[model samples]
Target chain A: MDARPTGFSRVTAPQFDPVVRLRDFTRSFGDNTIISGLDLDIAPGEFVILLGRSGSGKTTLLRTLAGLDPTPGQNVIVPASRAVVFQDARLLPWKKVWRNVALGLRQGDVRQRAEDALREVGLGHRLDAWPLTLSGGEAQRVALARALVREPSLLLLDEPFAALDALTRLRMHELVLSLWTRHRPAVMMVTHDVDEAIALADRVVLLDHGRIVLQERIEAPRGERGQVARALRSRLLGALGGQVLEGPSPAEIIALHAGGLA
Target chain B: MAISHRISASLGSARWLSPLLFLLAWEAGSRSGLIPERTLAAPSKVLSTLLDMAVSGELADNLWVSFLRIVIGLAIGVTVGAVLALVAGLSRQGEVAVDPLMQIKRTIPTLALTPLFIVWFGIGETPKIALIAFASIFPVYLNLYSGIRGVDLRLLEGARSFGLSCAEQILHVILPGALPSLLVGLRYSLSVAILVLVVAEQINASAGLGYLINNARDFMRTDIIVVCLMIYAVLGLAADALVRAIENRALVWRPSIVAQ
Candidate 1:
């Protein structure tokens, strides 16, 4: 394990192998290079957040990692089993909520597994509901259930909560954190929200012009995030080319956290 | 304002009222020797003739023959059109190979090919059914091809990320996404099938409503002719209603329909 700089302790669990490794990966579209010679690694059960401005190729990188892009790349080793939860819930409108969760599974009591997954996400009551009839947060929770039911080795989320309302987003953050802790799948989420990255990620990587410009490992304990959050916020804002403020107060964090857990 | 509201309320009910009034006027005109019953039979006379045909089983037999021809023709047309649409929609090679030829075929009105079909197939059931099938195929192909082509790329990407196979993607995503348009095609093709059936049966047929109509024209049996025409109108309405029912059930997930 790599040592952290002064005042920041390393919190990564030892003995875990890297689930995703990319070396010298390059992609371009018709002479306009998007991602060039990028290298990244995500350890098993690690939660990494990718932050970038618009057009920084964050979604492009996520898609490439999900194996959705057809273009050939160099030295990319993604897990054989992976799932993605998109910014839009992307549930098939034609399928019922339970069937959407059961999608891509071919064996072993798919309905039971889907029910269990939806129940985990607090959507057991929405098994037969239509996706269009669901609230934005409910739909996202169902999407989370769908991704998790596959029991993937790697989970990719592209701004999954960006469309949600503030209270719902807070709830979703807690839901995602709880689900991540329970499932222990390696996760890489892309987002534009700095506070979200600070709140959720084990490591936060900043991308600019398709290349990683800064990386920071968040070392604070899950429930004890207030102590180091301010210092971390300033550093992240500086990396993102923005001046730092005092940041959200400890009371706000507690209130948000309490509301989310409710 | 209240008087205006009352007037509008009555106007709304006038949809059915106007048709009833027209029937009443026709009956009165025919009974008073004004409409000239030889030229056009009264509604009551047409109804009586229809009852006579039904009692003799002649209406049932002719209607059965027409129904069988439509079913066979529509079955062939729908199957061929759907297969072609899928082939053309799924691949660039298929689009290039099949689309241009279909475009050319669409422009050559299938009704105009009746004479050519008669010469080729020789006044048999084959020619009549083939003509109906030809007329039905274009609408199904046009609508289905566009429908399949218009499937959202985002949904396809989402399916691909889940590692769905090509066949599975088509079955689950493409087919369901294209269903609304496919239903539209079905309705359009059904109407075309009936229209072509009318023409094909009129051109030459041993048994059908069209044959009954033609035979009545020779004897100046306007009442029988009116009865056959009424049957054709009823068949068209029934076909439309059937498609609407399927659409309501199949697209129940649609927000617009659900709100209704």
Candidate 2:
């Protein structure tokens, strides 16, 4: 690792109130248990990234945090207000772009608010455009705007940039960081790319076999990520039970890991 | 954009070519004695007959009666069908109570029940309107029910996450999603209504296009028969165009239809 300063000291204020909390939570589908006795807590304004191999209950955990899957008599506390962006944009094809962002908003200048939100996501020119007419990146941006318009206390992103090209994904990471900074909503993003997790998250978590296996805080500043990404990559891969190979970048390691399944 | 404009301009002219050619051949065939005027009245003769009937107010009177029957019957049939579809699509008990009966009714041809309807309601406007309504109900019910049932459950989950109440979800998400299918059903039902109206009016009617055709057949006036058939065809086309206009307006967000 480089000897540069890590930005850990920038977090000066104490974080007290938990935006999400789970204790002894367990979930199952018939005889197969997906999550069992998982305990976790997320504080307000924290940016947490979840990383795991496929079928490691990452989605189940995220859904549980979103309160979509309820386990009775287990302690699962989530804020009353929350928003989620899925892998697919999941926009309503029958609605215009602005109307889609304005969906379920009930009071006060809804059209103006929707327009403002779209503008924030760099989609002001597409208010009247149909969802089917948009490119995938544009559709995802509109989905982001829809999530932001609600101004929820908790924002859950389930691989929101998994479908984008490299350049677009980079732009989306910056966009997400800017939005997160402006709104200060507690964000929990699930991602497959280890670099992506290290780049955007304040804390990185690894999950395996229905349990959290490793947790690490990323202390590098945004501009100094290049100096520390290589070291973090091997650590994440080791936690995922894979050894880094020679002659390939960290992204290649992830691509090889993903390709091994097929 | 320029290429598309040129293509559409050519397509627009191509649409009129075949119909114009067919009319010319029809007129020529009748004049050449290859098709006798008595069998299939020449286009000119039909037009003249139409004009004469219009001048005498006979065409207008019959067309008005036919239009009234269709409007009333379609209104009643669509209302009943839509209500039943909503009831069934929204609940399991309603589906169990309504769907089987609808299926049985669907299997029974509306024409097969014409004689029974006449006996039950008597040979006045009641039986004729009832026949039209009975014929129209099935298409509307089947399409609307399937449309409501086929709404994406994923979208419903999204709506729930947005804190939409049950009624708002139905009004905004479910109904708009189903509008396209409902319009298709309306088109099918309108054609069925017209077909049943023709049959019903022929069975002892004082007025209507069917009555006019029956009268022309007794007198062997093929020109009048051809004229009445033309009116029915025009009415069907007009109703279809009306529904298309509504579909265009209501589904403006659909990218496939909204070309700039």
Candidate 3:
């Protein structure tokens, strides 16, 4: 056997305050630092949305949080099990829709759980159907079902709704919010859409150059989508450094958009 | 949407028409004396010879002998190849050790080893079967290795995220993902099996289609040779169709291109 080193060391850190926490994290791929000296905390059931540009290391951070890769000491304390929903809705092409949804289920009562999860995602009738026959929205719904069926302590989403059309994305957002309410699992979603971050997350963390540039808390009720969404959209655009041709104050930019200007 | 029926019908027509045209052309060319009639017998003569051979149980006995060799050789090859491919595809060290050996072995002609096989195992069923196994193993190994290793990283990560252990991930993700490619490899392996069988019979055999062809050659019975060749082609096509049927059932979740 070749004596090459493997990075699959299982470390059992103590359970401290938060369900998940990252402290003084640093990661690099051959000199290209994806995350360097980063620290964050997630309350047990807090919904945190990570916002960034395309190459802002949002996905990398989420992957690290999921224990998919090795990180520096004291970086992450991921719970026993977490589930992830990927952007591509990566369903196994040979499995049925139901099988894909119930991917993490053990034997015996797993059938019921899988069926329930499918029903929750509005894919009950697609249980026996082949995965390839599912539409993009259906596939994504199945992927969501797969993750939620695990009943994980933490849920990681990597731009999962980015591929959906506007209507589907909106519907999926509601479903996710509903799931979060029901399951109350800690969710850390990475997305490029600022409005999406504000709409879903309790706290929004803006990432730039692999470092947290800004963090803000959203103090709004979950069910009041219209008022909360509109308010949060305004706040998020400001955080993202929206354009200011006439040097409008941050408040004015929100006003200009809310008032139907440019 | 409605084009499915039309496409199926067109394919159906082509399927029968291709073989019919091939047989008609061969018969016409032979009868027209474009080739020497004795040297290249007509399709009708080959059919008659096949019938006579079947009635006398010569064809059946030869087929049984050949089929036995194919089955035993393919069984051994597939088992070994699958085990090696899985081990290599799973472990980095296994891949490093096995990949180079497979690469070198893949290029070595199966026929080139027949002489050595004869020297070691002797001119009996063992050598012929060994050659068939040698010929059949590589395609299955290459295809399976590629299929297993090429599974999407995101899906693997998703499995891991769900707290699935390595064994669960393999059962739920890797095996299913690799099924389609493995089916393709099985089909290719069957083809290789027949090809090596024919060659082995030609070199040294007292039974099977290869032996029949050899006997015809010795007796100057070109008609028998032509019939054996046709039987070989038919058997190969039938085996391929069987594998395809199995693949279609297994990969039902994989949609046609239009659906994608």
Best candidate (score: DockQ): 1
DockQ of 2: 0.47
Q: Each model's TM-score, in the order given?
A: 0.93, 0.88, 0.84
Clashing pairs in 1: none
lDDT of 3 by residue, B1-260 (tens): 57998988888868688889898998889888886766788889888988999999988998999899999999999888898899899899999999999999988998999889988998888998898888888989999999999988777877787777999999988888888788989999999999888888776777888888888888889999888888899989989998979977787666677665
Candidate 2 residue-wise lDDT, B23-140, digit = tens: 9999999999999866888899999999999999999999999999999999999999999899898889999999999999999999999889978999999999898888888888
Estimate the overall C-alpha local distance difference test score of candidate 3: 0.82
Q: What is the C-alpha RMSD of each candidate to the true structure, in Å?
A: 5.3, 8.3, 7.0
Model 1 misplaced regions, further than 4 Å: A1-16, A71-73, A246-251, A258-262, B1-13, B256-260
Q: List the lowest-lDDT window of 10 residues for candidate 2 chain A.
A: A1-10
Better of 1 and 3 by lDDT: 1
After superposition, the stretches of candidate 3 with alpha carbons farther than 4 Å from their true spots are A1-16, A223-235, A244-262, B1-43, B258-260
> Quick one: ranking by TM-score, best first?
1, 2, 3
